[model samples]
Target chain A: MATDAPRRGAAIGWYVLLSALSLIVLFPVWMTIARALSDGSATLFARTPSVLPYSPIQWDAFSRAFTEGGLGRPLLVSGLVTLIIVAAQTATAVGAAYAFAFLEFPFKRIVMVLCAATLLLPIEVTLIANIQTLQEVGLVSPSQGFGEAIGALTLPFLAQAFGIFLIRQGFLGIPKDLRDAAQLDGYSDLGFLRRVAVPVTRPVIGSFVLIAFLSAYNQYVWPRFSVKTNRWDTVQLALRRFGLDNPDQLNLGFAAAIIAALPVLVLLLVFQKQLIRGLTAGAVK
Target chain B: MGKRRNVRQWALAYALLLPSLVVFAVFAYLPLYRLVHFSLYQQSSRLGGGERYVGFGAVWDVLSGERFLQGTWITIKFLIFTVPAGIALGVLLAMAAHRRLKGIKIFQTIFSSTVASSVAVSSVVFLTLVNEQIGLLRNVSWLSLKSPNSALFAAALSSVWQNLGLTFVIVLAALQTVPEELLEAAHLDGYGAVRRFFRVVVPLISPALFFLAIVLVVYGFQAYAQIELITGGGPLRSTETLLYRITKLQKNTDLQVGASMSLGLFGLTFLVALVQFRLLERRVTYGN
Candidate 1:
């Protein structure tokens, strides 16, 4: 609409800046993929080897890195943990949000304040005591192994304070009339939440779930502290150890990074709109 | 229908809330309880011991150390560097994009995409880009990468760049709240772009800037991955922030010292945040 006359100078300035930033941002990612394709030609000291895949691409690096990095076990573990967290957080946040937004309750304001206050407590602060508590409960018994340890790491993060708050903000936008009518139609509170609030706020829920999942998957500190065995190292830990500690295995490290990053990249591509909306939603509030 | 329905509705509400309450109580509130209790005692659970009641002595011990004081100083320095830099860059980049230009969508996406970067990934990318041997920045430094001047500056520079996206998005959203008519009027009043920006646009969007500053301050304190990956808080602990020192101390002897230092660091962060929020509240205009 504003294109009647091209603002050539302003447009050029914007273009140059954007292109340069993109190049800076894209270079590392390009290097990873290119290295993976080039039989590790673009490893740590390899420089920008080649943008294109070699004629006989060494696809073995992917499989090698996957198993060699002990990624298969953790991938399954992280995937399962991520799913449980997403489902649990989404269900919990939506339920809590519905209660806060629509239902009248005693101490609603107090509960809301409690929810908001939880946002400021850093997990690292409580992590030591939390680990001790988990040990007492047998959830973190070393004998139970890495898979169970992954679950322990995910449990504390299962009910996110910010997710509940974000969902509450979204649910507040739903007019009282729809909810009131739904209640009058002989539906229970839970039923009304399911039929009315959930359907209305599906997009926000989807976005929050994705955000929560990605956040859980990308978690570094919690897993690093909680997971006792390297066998249970999540993708992020594997990437860090490989990329930093073992420089000689640079090609494999690059391959590992590419593998680790693939899921996030795919998630971004798939839910670009919702991801942007959910992230910016915090600032908008 | 009315009376019976109201009772059922309230019951259902409690039922819906039960799951989250259970999880939070077990995981969050329980851990919080343990933390408070642990802070009061002299012994860690790892070492089964005859318990000694120290009361608030641990908190006292935490705040009384030179290490803790140095940590507070470094953390404050980091906050000072990152928060203002993040907000300013965010605003500048947003302004640069605010002009009615072709391909604005591309710019917005490119800038905002960094919001998705985990601290770990951001650190890796930055470390690789600035590695003394292979980093893109290796060749640009007049001083060798090993030089304290280049090393510390480069580490800070990478963190600032990585965070620019988050700051940009917040400021850009704030910028959208500024009315176009006000800008047009300022232009008609013969104010140039810079004058109009400082006079009209800035005041309107100061709230977002303030919020972003607080967020960045919290992030700066929580800066672990960046320091760990790029410099390992090293080249002689010159780049070591409070967290890095705490972690290192923990790995070495003196878990008590490390825990105490962490608590002290947390206390300082809380105090500064409270003070900043109060001061910034005066300048930030939230609404029309």
Candidate 2:
């Protein structure tokens, strides 16, 4: 039992070390929460940084963040834009992946190269010209309304090369016999795609969906320029403006930041498996 | 009949692929073409109000300019500061949590909790955390809020923290794939934990490390929200990355200059990707 005792002690040591590391990693988030819960008088004029919320915790920062900080509209707009982009990306990715996996066409090699090339040209590289293009098309102008700006925000992201590649890998995993049996049962190509391929590959699609939602929801650069006015700002943009505009009531800004991050944290909790799968898909063999 | 069926199948396939092809054409390919076209012209106003052909002059000017050089150098410095530190921390965290100890899953979750924070949220959190008046780290001498020189480091700190969750999750996944027998074999051979980690565990997980390195480099180049919210490329443009410079030029309606910088950034990224593959891929062991 001497060896057992040493092993158990080693494990306890590991626990202590890991717990300390986790606290350091999580300190910034904790500080934000504590500051958000404290009143302005408590946080602003304090000489020492408090690790926890001060007495008489104020809950009005969140309400003020939503109402006065103007995060409510942006939150709704971000949600709507995220939903549209997610749905469009899924549809486009599925169709393209299905074609690449199961069908043949002229210029197939060339088209595949074209699709892969887009992976190298990220949105940052094309931001300048895209803004001009969108402006010319009336999709991103001060004169345009919210609908056109939404088009601009969601258009460039309607399809993604990574999503296509990922879903194609999923489709390729379906056995040949499954495809032949579906055909023999008088299922058309589209019918097989809908009834068999999609159901079988739901896990991959789910992962892609979650990843796509996270990316779309957290987009900062595109929305920063595309949306012309505060009327159509996304949540990220609103948080920045609010934080910069309200230095005195920084607690409200912290609360808005928390509110902004709430959805993705909940998604992380619920879809932890899919997120890990999607994130590490291409990283490993 | 066979040829006709083939033609019909090909038509169906193309039909299915049309939406994606069209979107790519409009957004990706066309924008690249226009960026080149716009860069070659001199414009009198923001959106091409009055234009004159200026064959590569603006591009040459941007390439030779001090702003572009400084921005590129700062971006490279930012990459240097963040990438290795991020990978090292990720490896350390993964190693700590990769064991089969009881309740280890909770520790793993906490290690990756930062993944939920968006760049804006993380930047603001760090902003307040480092505020001079009331920040948690305000009194920390090295990261002093009074100095403008610490601006880039401050932004890099946030990026590293924000990326820790993703890096930890990916590395942990890689660590899990290390065969238990291999490590046990190494242990039985009288190798200490440190030696085994560097010799056995690292080589086995080198592919993931390499992948993480490339991704972090790309992320370093693409980082903007952190800089924008934290420093506003601030104090004296010390934190202005190439992408941030291009954004500033765009705001000033200098489309030609912005386009030139964008293409420059693209070429830089391409070169970096090539260099990384050349330097790092040789050591990556693919299979057991």
Model 2 CA lDDT for position B85:
95
Residues A1-285, candidate 1: write the lDDT tens digits: 477357666567678876786776566666555555544333444554234554346667777776666667667777877888888898888888888887776677887787777666666555565666777677666575754776787878778788888899888888989877886898766677778878888888888877887788877766766776666777777666666345435556657666666687678767877875675665665
- Give the CA lDDT, 0 to 100, for residue B245 in model 2: 90
Candidate 2 global lDDT: 0.87
lDDT at residue A79 of model 1 (Cα atoms): 83
Question: Residue by residue across B129-166, what tens digits does model 1's lDDT show?
Answer: 57775555566664235765555566666567767767
Worst 10 residues of 2 chain A by lDDT: A241-250
- The per-prediction CA RMSD against the true structure, in angstroms, equals 3.9, 1.7
